[model samples]
Target: MTETLDPEDAKIITLARSVRARNGSTEGAAVRDETGRTYAASGVDLPSLQLTAVQVAVAMAVTSGAKALEATALVTEADGPAEQDLSVMEDLHNGTLLLAGPDGSLKGRHV
Candidate 1:
């Protein structure tokens, strides 16, 4: 059965998908802060710097002055989130993580 998502979560899924498509990255991630501000980013691949979508998204939130995160969403084909992704979320706040397929279908969730 398909999982139902809150409207805010659905927005993040859409943002992640757009970032992934725009960058042609393997994965995309979006995070919402306690104040309801959202940040979105795609995986970063560089000769000197390599970061997952979730990592980048979290960093963006932190750099933008987000004290805590309310939720996170990733749009990708991966079966689950990576260890680093979970670490980032833990650093911010213990919140829900929604995983979605490339087609925007809810795949899994972690809290």
Candidate 2:
């Protein structure tokens, strides 16, 4: 976590970590929309379909009528999020994006 991380952002990171642990997934993510609504999801992996945690979280926000995002948090064991994950986050609002390890330590921050 950042030295001055916002409480809301910290909450989303916690939410992401919770879902990751709950689902037993390698990755998890949470997004806060413009309306202050937050969505959390774990990465999906199936024979027919696959999605990164960030992708799933962003999709959830979009499906829930979120016009844009306010913030995003991802918890994963990977060094950082995938390119497509960053792309999807960019496709939405230019909000604060955080990448953290499963232990909740900040790894990277993307706009």
Q: The CA-based lDDT of model 2 is what?
A: 0.90
lDDT of 2 by residue, 7-110 (tens): 99889999999999999999899999999999999988999999998899999999999988999999988887789887898789668889889898888888
Instruction: For residues 1-111, write the lDDT of model 1, one tens digit per residue.
Output: 387889999999999999999999999999999999999999889999999999999999999999899999999988999999999899987689999998899998899
TM-score of each candidate? 0.97, 0.94
lDDT, candidates in the order shown = 0.92, 0.90
Predicted model with the maximum TM-score = 1
Model 2 residue runs over 4 Å out of place are none
